[model samples]
Target chain A: MTQTSKKPAAVEALGLTKIYGSGNTEVIAMKEVSLSLARGEVVALLGPSGAGKSTFLTAIGLINPPTAGRIVIGGEAVMDGPRALVDLRAFRRRHLGFVFQKANLIPFLKAVENVAIAMEINDVSPRAARKRALELLDYLGVGDRARNLPDALSGGQQQRVAVARALANQPSLILADEPTAALDSHRGRQVMELFRQVAHEHGSAVIVVTHDHRSLDVFDRTYEMEDGELGAKHSPPAPTANSTPSA
Target chain B: MNLAAKDIRHNLGRFVLTAIGIGLLLMTVLGMSGIYRGMVDDAMVVVDRIGADLWVVQHDTRGPFAEISRVPANLEHRVRAVPGVASARSFVSHNVQREHRDEPLRMNVHGLAWPEDNGAWVTLTAGRPLGQAHYELIADASLGLALGEKLKLGKDTYTVVGIAKGMVSSGGDGLAFFTTQDALAIQVDLPGDALRLERAARVQRAVAQDLGQVQPLLLERGAGMASGIPALGPPMVSAITVRVAEGVDAAQVAATIAAWPDVSVHTRDDQEALLVRGMIDKARRQIGLFRVLLVVISTIIMALILYTLTLDKIHDIAMLKLMGARNPMIAGLILQQALLLGALGYGIAWVLGGWVFPRFPRRVLITSEDLWALAVVVAIISVFASLLGIWKAMRVEPNKVLA
Candidate 1:
């Protein structure tokens, strides 16, 4: 796949640090980590187990407040020096999306309702939320499965539904933590490709933390992590020699 | 909005089961309350039906069914002679056990003037009132006796001549009406065999008396021995019911009659208040204890059911929170489900209590107003019961989803 120049940073974090417990029992998960991602870009965060990938993702997700950091999303200074500058819950709802290892859909709800609940939490009306959810599902090529429950669909179909749910509110940034870890390689690569498509088409910056390397080519840029630090970047070879120049 | 409805639909079976359990409990509570109210109403039915303005009895006695009371029969004339007095009649009431079809039935026999001057006291539903003072009787329809049936009362057989409706004592016993003379006889008369035995024992005691032991002749010829009449006994009437004139003030008449040392007077309102006060003062504590037990049981059951439901969906609730759903929103979902269960339960209870309680052997009266009041009370209790689950749900952290 040909790559385009980064479209300008949509999310930035500096000096992010997270410590657990205190005194003799204290342990640091991440120390002075800094990173940035631009719009319409999909960045793969490759790491082994317990490599602080989850800690950094949660801190940026606004769920776990970092011990100290400066984090910015969509041109808004939401966190400065570990203190939240905005309502965390409201900000997360409006500006960020999340996909977990499991589909994590509400079991009681149908596929469409699961997608719509995100919008409803932000005070969207049911009629309008449902309409937008259907549109997103259709765009993600899972419109026919909108009426089925999460349990009734295949693993890949369920993940597609989750991706559609994350895009329902049109958030500025999407955080995916091992979203493809539960699927087989073929389905896993398919989900990664869908996330890439979502980031490009919707102009939202996407970051995926995964140990699965089979789908690494689906990402726009790949960054390796070892011992809580971003190591080196390895760009995938272009699909064809005669392909158009990188934008 | 979608979450609340979806949660309910997902667990429809469990919700229905909880509602049914609550419905059964509510039915019992409603029935008990109705039964208590019915007892009060039935107790006052006879008095209200009598429609008398005043009741005169022995001084210091509650009278009628509450206590023993007696006064001279002639007081009826004295009460009538008072200024503003319309008319007056003497009545005597006493509880007696009689045999009907070999079954012993306890009833209150009321003795009134012959030709039944107190006809207005009862409405005859069958047959006619007494024509003669001696052998005729009016019986309440509840006794299930037909006209011309003879009821044995204290060695006398009185034929039923009329059937009266709504004539019952506070004890729920049927009321039987007869002449004053017959009532006096029944009150004082003994069986022929018993009377003969008494006379024989007295003669034997006289024969055995020593001449020095107070003169045998004097013992044998006691006062009125030649006349063969027994000595006069205490005044026999149980109570005297009075109807004051249209312009008469019952309070004034009661005070004037109270001046007489041997009798007392109570207005209609006084009698009703006494009955109500008696029931409440006697049974309030017991009823309150039962009500408290019922409330406690209902709360425990509700809490258990709700807690079980919450446990079943811990993961779902965690996921919802992780998706940026506010704590209040999630709490609202649980609360809405609880309230819906309560509403369905109350509706079923109302129907069950209304349809089934009255048919009970004992009186169970449930009024519509009482039903409405209980519904509001149940709603408040339901809301309180749901609050515990809401609190538990709010304390659940979204991070628990990962765990």
Candidate 2:
């Protein structure tokens, strides 16, 4: 499939810093981090343990307000120097989605309910939420598993369901932390390809924090982080003859 | 909207266990409340059953049932002659013991005038009312007295002519109905030796005359030698129960009698208030204490249960928060679950209290209004209980999902 990447940047963060305590005992999780990602683009953030990759992801995802920074999402300057211009939670709900290391689906709910919960939280009616949830699941190729629970699905299927749930609200950006850490290389690569497809087709800016390098070529652009600072950026490697198309 | 149903489904075992525990506590609260109502009902049973509008007793006393009251038997005649007084009857009440199949039974003896005897307070599960005033008694079946059985009361042997049911005093003592004469005999009659001793003491007092009476005093003044015939004193009665005439205000009549120096009258409302104060006051306070304690305990248990459940799902809550779920949505979920638990607990308690309370030795009455009041009370408690969990859940940082 021919992939055209021409969308402009959807999120930009400059000099982001997070500090935990005052004078006597202070801890800094992330310091002076700058990043930007365009819409319809998928990027991979590679880092070692305790390298502030998770902190940077959370700061950009609007889950935690950076101590000092300028954050612009979907062309809106929402955060400036620790002050949020709009309702942080509401802005996040409308513009952002999140995927954790685990599927993190609500266990009591069925696969469809898991996805529908996101819509309901945003005040979507039950009928509309259910319809949208099923449509998203069908688009993600998991409509047949709508009635099953998270535990009933395989690891790969669970992560796919999680991806469907993240896209349920049609967010403009998606932040995933270790989304493919629990899957085999093939399944991890497959999930990586799905994220690429979602970012391009749905026009979302996708940033995935992963330790796996087997699916490095699946992303449009990749960046590395070491000790809370972004390293050199790299382009996707050219497609190889053995690069099998993912289903 | 709120994920309350989902939360309960997720932790069903814990939810059900907590509900059952709450149900048992609620059952206790409901039962105690019912018992309080029953006490009021029991205290009013005799008055309601007798259908009397006014009661006359000695001055400065509440009544025959609440306190000791005695008046001249002739007072009934005088009261019957009063305007708007349809009729008056004498009644005597005293606690007495009798033998039932070789086992002693404690009971309250109510003496009624012949033909003026009101029927039993409750339907007889087995026998009938006494047809004759003499040598016959209507006994509660709870007293274990069989029909046709002869029971010895102080010095008189009374045949159990009929069996009654639910004829119990407010103190839970069974009742037996007899003629006024028998009750007086049992209450006032003394042994021959005791009577002789009293006459001897009086004779000695009369013989020791004052020296100021210089003339020879007549020996007839002595107790032993009777003056022509001993003056007959009026018979004493416990109380006079009066039925007010149609269209007459019983309160007004009571006020009229209150003006008399040696007599006091009580309207139905006054008697009912006094009965409630005297018989059920302490029990009501005790039930109130139980209700307060149960509420405190239930609130604590619910708070702890909810807190634990919230703590258990901290990660899930954090993830939901990270996914942009609002504080109100999360809070609503917890509150809704608490309300559902409360409703379930109350439903179980209603059934349990209804089934088990009436079987107690004392009466227990449950009413729809009481249930409604309790439901509202439980709902308020549930809201308070959920506050802790909601606060904890809302305070959870979405960033914690990363940790």
Return the TM-score for each candidate structure. Answer: 0.86, 0.88
Model 1: what TM-score?
A: 0.86
- lDDT tens per residue, model 1, A35-95: 7888878888888887788888988988788998789898898988679999887888888
Q: Write the per-residue lDDT of candidate 2 for residues B281-392, one digit (tens) a residue.
A: 8878988998999998998898888888888878888878877887887888788888998999998898777788767887677888889988998999899999999999
Cα lDDT listed for each candidate? 0.78, 0.81
After superposition, candidate 2 runs with Cα above 4 Å error: A1-7, A22-24, A235-247, B81-84, B97-104, B118-125, B141-146, B188-235, B245-259
DockQ of each: 0.50, 0.60
Real interface contacts reproduced by model 1, as a fraction: 0.42
Looking at model 2 chain A, which ten-residue stretch has the lowest summed lDDT?
A1-10
